[model samples]
Target: MEAWLDGLPADSVGLRNRGLAYGDGLFETIAVHNGRAVLLERHLQRLAVGCQRLALGHDATLILTEVTRYAAAMGEGVLKLMLVRGDSQRGYAADPGRPAMRILQASPPAAYPVVHAEHGIKMFPCATRLAEQPMLAGLKHLNRLEQVLARAEWQDSTFAEGLMLDTAGRLVEGVFSNLFLVRDGRLLTPDLSRSGVAGVMRSELLAQAERAGIPVWIGDLRLDDLAQADEVFVCNSVYGVWPVQAFAALNWPAGPVTRKLQAIARSLLDA
Candidate 1:
C-alpha cells in the first residue's frame, strides 16, 4: 500500500496559497487499474489546462510524475491530485510569482458494488442547483460545495446517485458523473460549456461514438426531456458506465447502445 500525508504544514504562509484562504485550486480523481492509470495523458492534459486557467505556475508535469510514482506503488486503487496556489497571504489577489503547491494521494479502491452494473441505480432530483460558472465549468475545481449539498439530499444506498440541474433548470449532470440519455434512437448529453464536470469517461464515449458512427447531440435538457428518454446512463472514470434503471417514475433499460459503450469502458479498465 502507498503511504499518505495528513495535511500541509503550519508555516505554509505565502501570499500565493489562495487555496487555503479561498479554495483556489483544482483536483482530479483518477482510476488506477491493474497498475495502470486509465486515460493518464488526458488527465494530465486537463490538470495542466486547469493550472493555466488559474494562473498557477506551469509545473503539472512535476505533479504528474509524483502521482505516477505513488500509483505505481499503490497497486490497484484511486489517485487524487489537488493543485492549489501556493501559500498566499490573506487575500484573493493572487501573486504571479508564487509556485503552485500540490497534494497527491492514493487511496483504497472505492468498492463499486458490482450489483449497480447489473441492476442499475435509482437516482433522485436534488433541490440544490448547480451554479453556472463558465470559467470554472468543466474543470474539476475545489469549489464543489454545490455537489456536497446536492448529494446530501439522501443517504439511501439503493439510490446510487443524485441528478442535479443547473440554475436554468437544464439537466446538467449527476453529483459526481456525466449523464447521457437516448431518445428516438439518438444520443444526447448536456453540454458542459455552461456547467458540470467534463468527465474523462464522457470524452471517451464521445470518441467511441465517432468511431462507431454514432452521432451525439450536446444540448440543453429539462426534466420532461429525461422523462421521455428511451434510456439513461451516468459515467465516470472509475465506475465506467451505469444505465439508470429508474429515476423517480421514469424507467430505462440497459439499452443496446449503452451496453456497447459499457463493454468498451470495461475493456479500457481491463487493459
Candidate 2:
C-alpha cells in the first residue's frame, strides 16, 4: 500500500527531506485492532519525548487525530507513524522554523510461528554492540544502523531474536524488542539510560507488573544475570511477548512470572 504524507497518498518523499537526507526523524510502530491503535497513549508519549529531545517541533493533536483516523481505516494491521524534520537545504543545520512532516504507512500484521510463543524460542548472541549515546538513548529515532547490523548477524531460523549489548558489554535489549528476566519472583530489565530503545510494550509491562505487586528493577544487567534468571522473555509492540528458552548454553523455563506477563501482553495486543 502507498504511504500517506501529511495525510495524503504519496509515492515518494522530497529528496531534500531531512528524514531521507540524514535520518533526522522519529517513528512509532503501532498494532491496530478493531479500528483502534493499541497502546496509543504510550506510543504518543514516547514520540513526544523524542520530538523534545531532537528539538523537532510537532503538533501532538494533529498526529493523534491522523493516527486515529489511519488506524480506523486500517482495521487490523501494523501502523507506522514517521515524523521527520521536514525538508532542509544542503547543510547539516536544520531550519528551526520549518514544520515537521508526518508519514503514515500500514501493513499486514506480523506472522511468526505459534510454537515460538507457546514453546518458547532461542536467542542469538549478537556480536554487534550498541553505542552509548545518552542524547539518543531510549528514543526510537530513524538512525538504527546498530540494530540493523545486529539483526543481520543471525540468519538461522533456530534463533527467533538476537540479544544486543552495549559497547561496554552490558546487556541492553533484543535487536527489535526489550529483554526481561525473572529471578526470585522479581522482574529485572536492562537500563536504557545509556543505550537501547525504551520500547512501548516494555514500559507497559513495567507498569502492569508493578500494579500486580511484582518487584521491578531497572538497572544494569549482564550475562551473569541471564544465567541466574529463572525466566527470560523478549517483548515488542508487534509480537507482544516471546519466552526465551535458550541463549547460548544457558537455558530457562517459561516460568510463572513470564507466563503471567505474557498473558497480560497478549490481552493488550489482542484487545
Instruction: State which candidate has the highest TM-score.
Output: 2
Per-model TM-score, in order, reads: 0.92, 0.99
lDDT of 1 by residue, 129-216 (tens): 9888888889998888999999889987888999999889999999988999988877899988888899888988988977887778
- Models, CA RMSD each: 2.8, 0.7
- Pairs that clash in candidate 2: none
Q: How many backbone clashes does candidate 1 have?
A: 9
Candidate 1 clashing pairs? 14-87, 14-88, 14-89, 15-88, 15-89, 16-88, 17-86, 17-87, 17-88
How big is the positional error of residue 106 in model 1, measured in Å on the Cα after superposition? 0.9
Residue 101's lDDT in candidate 1: 71
Could you say which candidate leads in lDDT? 2
